[model samples]
Target: MTQITAAMVKELRERTGQGMMDCKKALNAAGGDIEKAIDDMRAAGSIKAAKKAGNIAAEGAIAVKVADDNKAAVIVEVNSQTDFLALQDDFKGFVSDSLEKAFAAGYTDAAPLIADQESAREALVAKCGENVNIRRLARVEGDVIGAYLHGHRIGVVVTLKGGTVELARDIAMHVAASNPQFLAPSEVSEEAVAKEKEIFMALNAEKIAGKPENIVENMVKGRINKFLSEASLVEQPFVKDPEIKVGDLAKKAGAEVISFVRFEVGEGIERAEVDFASEVAAQLEASKK
Candidate 1:
């Protein structure tokens, strides 16, 4: 058997970020073959990733890539089990690469983009020692496309018939900030409207008590209209200029919001609550074992 030197153990530790003892063991296990040691380490990392696959990875970032001509763009979300992992340069770089690939492929649906990224994603998962997911992606194209990123947490893409980048960006930023549910009141589903009406009526039953049935009906209608106004993007008060409605702002800019998509990292994922002290103690106990 080849002897494992201190230099070999140090090199393996530096390459894999594994503990000194772990690196030495892997090096010895590979019989002093550095390349084989790396492969073994990676395999171990893959095992850890598999064990972590079910962990909630609700913390992550969004990456947006726009074409040079501003007529098309793509946004992708990469999720990590922890915010600390999400903030790493390597994780961010992976997300950026995924965005560029999605933009280049011009995929309207996320399925093809995800399928193309599987191998790279698995490698990333192993490297990060966590389960990483290319959670979702969206592509938008129009005569004019604008993209906005609010830090790494939120991303917005807007498609317009005709608009300056500034106008589109403003709209996109509004979308990121306001989280509008629909582009227009008409886009609000009938089922949603019905649900909101039922809720409003239930909540304000006492206020309409003893009133005429016609008057109560009008009150419910008014409340439903108000709900739509608040939920619809076009009717929302502009985030930059609250005096004007978003629709009016678009009209004044000689453009209209054709379409927009907003993505906020971890918007729907259920995050697990972890007790840090218990976790560290558990790790210490495991090491002793």
Candidate 2:
């Protein structure tokens, strides 16, 4: 039998927001695998969802650059050890320079651009006394490209076919706000749909019990459709006007959304927690030696 440790329980609690005992039980059942425990808990409806970008602890800034002709755009994320450093002008300049280099070179991958900026990044880190990283970059090109940055924290680039730049900007703004996972319902994968069905069934087990097979099937299908709409961009209600869907808004403007990329600072990056009091006590004890 695998032993469940306190650290594992703490991690699971952070990821799923579950109670310590429940997380321990889940961890024990999964043989000390944290990811598996989370999946099992989610399947059993004990957790509605795992941690999201809002729960991310890391600090950073996102930058976006658009072409003069509105034909292409690039978005980049640069991470820092603390928000104070991220707010510093040097860090902000580094982020902007990274974005410009990626945009000028039309580079989709961040590696070469990061390598190019290594010296400047190192200089900033030395000056700030904190680690910094040029984390990721993405580029989008289409008949019309629009970019939007939400106060340096979130950046979005949207591409459209047969759309005006104004329309594209509006959609990009919507993407920055809504953070949809897919451009349309068709882009949602079958595996994602199946997982949603499993979660819905588990959460509604009592209500669905003893129902006719056809009725249960209909309920599952309804839930899947709801999930699809919520996850897809075109199907989502317009942020500006609740009465109309984004698809309808696009159709009215004779445009189709080609694709979009949304970047939020420190997304998917886990930062270690610090115990300042413990560190201070240790420092005092060492001083007495």
Candidate 3:
């Protein structure tokens, strides 16, 4: 019998980029032999799966699933390298399965859900012949939940203490369109306000150079308020009815917006630009050699 050590597992994980438990199990199965563990892991496709980790998977769909009771909803973004793969039925199925599993298990974060679907994810990657990644996940559970998915590209979930499904869905749709950064004006951070103010002041420095200090202060204050109105969900006008603020609409409906989250596929990822003809030519040239 071989005694497996944490140090051995760490080394194997570092070399292979596989999960800690998977490396540990491999190490234990190989009698604490790191090389044999590596071989066995590769034979099991774990190494091949891990190798796909470096590929850029920035294009995919946003999947939103609500619990049967409608009290909870989960949104997940699963990424692939190209839209072609993203639109595939198999890829869509994986995203749906991942969201369902997360919703059923009440997962609020991506880490646990990713771990839970590790084998399935690996299998999907192999089947797709491309890197498939569960990029982000968010779940909201509340007294009432409203979810809206826009063309499978953007998803919004809203939670309220007291609200009709219509109100909730309306708020979610507004969130999808407005893309507010804060739930309310009060939720806007002082640091963010200061940063925006600084930029505004710098840009208008010459215009305000000779103005009275009080007047300049008022100008800055007005600009900041305008910025807050645009960035705060409650302060923004409702998308359906532009005359009323979202806060007023919520209040009229006897509901308070608890929290909301919006997800857009590949929001922050920088995708690589590859020249396909050149890539094919290079592959052909390499084959001749």
Q: What RMSD, rounded to one decimal, does every model reach?
A: 7.5, 14.9, 7.8
Position 9, candidate 1: lDDT: 81
**lDDT digits (tens) for residues 1-289 of candidate 3:** 7899898888888768888999989988999988778768878766855444346888889999877677988999998888899888998888989998988888888999889888888778756767788989998889889999998789999998897888999999999999999999898999999999999999999999999999999999999999999999999999999999999999999999999989998999987787999999999998997
lDDT of each: 0.84, 0.84, 0.88
lDDT of 2 by residue, 1-289 (tens): 8789898898889867889999999999999988678668867878744653123336889888888999988888888777887888888888888888888787997999988998787567546656677888888888998888899789888888887988888988999898899999999999999899999989999999999999999999999998889899999999999798988898889988889899998888876777899989999998997
Pairing residues by index, what is the TM-score of model 3?
A: 0.79
* Predicted structure 1: lDDT: 0.84
Regions of model 2 farther than 4 Å from truth = 1-57, 275-289
Pick by lDDT: which candidate is best? 3
Candidate 3 displacement at residue 49 in angstroms: 1.2
Query: Would you list the clashing residue pairs of candidate 1?
Result: none
lDDT of 1 by residue, 14-81 (tens): 65667898878887889998767777766766223232424777889998988889998888888888
Candidate 3 lDDT score relative to the true structure: 0.88
